[model samples]
Target: MVGLLGWLISFFVLIALLVLVVYQLMCLADLEFDHINPYDSATRINQVIIPEYVTQGGLFLIFFLTGHWLLALLCVPYLYYNIKTYMDNRHFVDVTEIFNNLNWEKKKRLFKIGYLVATLFLSLFWLIWSSVEDDELGF
Candidate 1:
């Protein structure tokens, strides 16, 4: 029973982390396009949101449902890359970068921090999960 509870907790936490990553991707795509093309900001922003949401949702959902060690193996590097990029680019901001500069700055800052933390936690969890015993769950 305790082991079952632990598995449930881990599963929910993974789902939350997946959702958080999706949110971060939305923000990243939004900021990138807004930086590249300032004129079509509204249209560009609107265009990317739905697709980003859908793509991340579907991808993470597949990963969660499959719940295979091989799938987790594939995601580790990607999560590490995101963590590295988030840390590397957290400070620098171009003058044209509107997301972190202007209104809702605090919110954007929090999201960036949260994204990095989530990625780190997710990667660490994967490492531990892989190294630990398979147990009965085969998670």
Candidate 2:
């Protein structure tokens, strides 16, 4: 029971962290595009941004499965670096141009609402799966 509880706690924490990482990435994408071309039909943000989060999420899942708490913990720094790089790249353009192009209110609202819902669903799944006793059932 203790082992199961520990696993559940760890899984929930990892899910929360993964959701945060993904949400940060999405916000970064919004920031990146807001200045250059709000209407630009580029799927690069979705393609590149989402897959990176998925990969990290998969890594966390694997680490959780293997009970490698230290390895899973390292993802926090990795996620930070990913977002930092994305932000640093945004500085090359003129500040005035970027500011003029941005719709800050809309971007903020969209990111907050979308990310909140996504994180909620993801955390719920993690919580559910973590609570299940391995010996009790098959799913």
Candidate 3:
């Protein structure tokens, strides 16, 4: 039961993070191609960053509080990175510095997308298998 609940919550939060990363990725591409002004691009990216942090932090916190230790443990590294960036007050990209950091920013988003996809798959696999198992047991 706890496993089902953990995976279910993880599934939704992972979906949300995937969307955020992909959106950030699109914004980075546009900024790179001169399709969007640096100010607007930075602003958009910054807009998403806080919510991403909050949502991600909330996800892991929920896991920990709910006794989903494995899931919480899996998320610790990223959470720690997020905390480090926050503590350094460098979590958001600077508008004037956008051009200089474009490649690095894109790579970061790509890495996040990769990580989120991997976690998403794990949650999805459990969700599917659990549902099928439940159906088999007629519960």
For every candidate in turn, the CA RMSD to the true structure comes to 11.9, 10.5, 1.6
Off by over 4 Å in 3: 1-3
- How many residue pairs clash in all the candidates, one count each? 0, 0, 0
* Per-residue alpha-carbon lDDT of candidate 3 for residues 1-139, written as tens digits (9 for 90 to 100): 5557766877888899889989999998999999999999999999999899988998898778877687789889989989999999999989999999999999999998888888778778878887888778877
In model 2, residue pairs whose N, Cα or C atoms come closer than 3 Å (at least 3 residues apart or on different chains), thus clashing, are none
Q: What lDDT score is found at residue 1 in candidate 2?
A: 53
Ranking by lDDT, best first? 3, 2, 1
Clashing pairs in 3: none
Candidate 3 clash figure, as a count:
0
Q: Rank the candidates by TM-score, best first.
A: 3, 1, 2
Give the TM-scores of the predictions, in the order they appear: 0.34, 0.32, 0.91
Question: Can you write out model 2's per-residue Cα lDDT over 1-139, one digit (the tens) per residue?
Answer: 5445655555565555545445544544666665434333133333445455455556556555666575556555555544674667641223345435445533643654464455446545644665575446542
What stretches of model 1 exceed 4 Å from their correct place?
A: 1-39, 68-102, 105-113, 127-139
